[model samples]
Target: MAGCFDVMQHNASFDWDTRRNTYSAIFAGFLFFFAWWLVIDTAVVFTPTGDWNNWYFALAVSCSLSMFMVNSVSNRALEGLYSEEGVLGVKGTRIWLMFGFIGSFACIIAGIWIMFGDYVLQKNDNPKWPGVAIFLHTLLTFIASLTYKFGRSEELWD
Candidate 1:
């Protein structure tokens, strides 16, 4: 009950670190959950013949991989605070981060391709929900990863 009032207040401010972190985490979690829910529900509810293949899950899978690549290194490490001790140096972190961004963008491009090449351009009796779900999965997961990675202030934590 007390927690409900705390979350219900519209006058919340980022000045409160715990509040900011809580809100960001909640928002990111909601987006991720909703995205997966939509994709899975669409896949199950609108299963067409021979068209609903494994390729539809590529977007979500790639997004998860990208998130791992991007966030596996801590912000302190990226900032060169622990350059000498880690197996992956600052340069390696940068390289991984770069590839993560690349993979993230690639998945989005693939989503677009699935939406157009598979569903839009294909002249079949298949439902278009798969394509749309794939695209939304990529987009929402990317956004959620960004939110979880950047929205919190880890600099304050030890």
Candidate 2:
């Protein structure tokens, strides 16, 4: 039953710092902010070439929604199957979180595809930074999300 919940438990012997939770949260927050910063820079540095250009900014929106999906579930929801607290049972919660992870990963892959296919592969005068920036945004967000989810001290909150 522990499966995914294994990391939720505290391990004092492996701890590098007494403030592990605080540090993990700070790192996660920085990553999240940096992710948005990169995407916003993409939005600012590049003007819309046309309605099609709007897809660049749309990636940010999609990443944000997917981030919400990943972070929306509580750790406890997955820890207890028989508990009456969550409306969604353990299986449902697991599925919801799974979809979230999938969405986030998909966003990053799409960003990579756009970077190479649209900018790198093409011989247009357009700079490659925009594509790279978008990819960074999605990748950073995905890393930040997983870090926030798994890096925190679950027992501290309990």
Candidate 3:
């Protein structure tokens, strides 16, 4: 058991100049775990005893997944902005970055829209956990992506 633990620690000890990647990865993992738990808890374990169908679970899952995908794509697209040379040239790189920014904002807006339209409007008297979870997931996804993108900066105040 000690040998196994030593091997695991050795494998995990990689040189990282900054803590952004580690922090972002941790945050993303936590967000995903929380989302999974929330869905399982609400949809399966603690479900209200009825024949009712709660669509919020599906919506929350979809929104969280979409936010993650959008963040990933945007992060990849941002690579072009930092490259010294690209096949598509500087203009194309700028375009890619612009599109990525737009997509990120669009995902955020969509999350807000779903929260307001599905939860706030429908359950005005009693707001539920699903909407809040989706919103928090979206925000976390955005922060994680930004952290990954800007984490490599050599600036004094990063």
Candidate 4:
């Protein structure tokens, strides 16, 4: 069984990082739309709470914060991997990759909140299972993205 698993394993490489970056950017865009859907649903459900415009504002703020975090992380990663000349050439592009991961995380979180809050208030929902599902999905997706370059390599804590 271990041998079978080893046969299918992948390893870290620059090529792998490049592929991951493409996928990351695509997913990030998906997250932006996902957040939009959630906010719209929330406002529609809770129109009595106030005007619908505020929910869009919340979504915008969350995405903006996420982009800031993404840029910060990407900047560090680029600095570590490239020389100053390389960094100058690529830094602007790297920011997009960071934006993807951060945006995905933010959208997933907001989606959970919007979907569950109204469910609980209007449908007498119990959120224990749904909450766990949301958490695990978010965590697993994040870990998967972060480790895409490492492939099958396992990291152990000392």
lDDT string for model 4 (21-127, tens) is 55655565565455445445544654564423344445445554554455444343454544554443565546666566668577667646744663434555343
Candidate 2, 1-158: lDDT as tens digits? 85888768775664545667788878889998998888776676576653136567777778777888988887878777344856778888889999998889889889999989988898767788878888898888888888878887667754
Candidates' C-alpha lDDT: 0.80, 0.79, 0.55, 0.49
Candidate 4: stretches off by over 4 Å: 1-20, 49-60, 75-79, 85-158
Error (Å) of candidate 2 at residue 25 is: 1.5
lDDT of 1 by residue, 6-63 (tens): 6664854466566667777788899989888978887777665555676577678778
Q: TM-score order of candidates, best first?
A: 1, 2, 3, 4
Stretches of candidate 2 off by over 4 Å are 1-18, 48-52
Using all chains and alpha carbons, the TM-scores for the candidates as numbered come to 0.82, 0.80, 0.53, 0.36
Residue 18 C-alpha lDDT in model 4: 42
TM-score of 3: 0.53
The alpha-carbon root-mean-square deviation between model 4 and the true structure, to one decimal in Å, is 10.4
Indicate the TM-score of model 2. 0.80
Q: Residue 147 CA error for candidate 3 (Å)?
A: 0.7
Write one digit per residue (lDDT tens) for candidate 3, span 72-112.
43333445444455465656655655666566566667668
Best by TM-score: 1
Q: Residue 140: error of model 2 in Å? A: 0.3
* Candidate 1 Cα errors over 4 Å, as ranges: 1-16
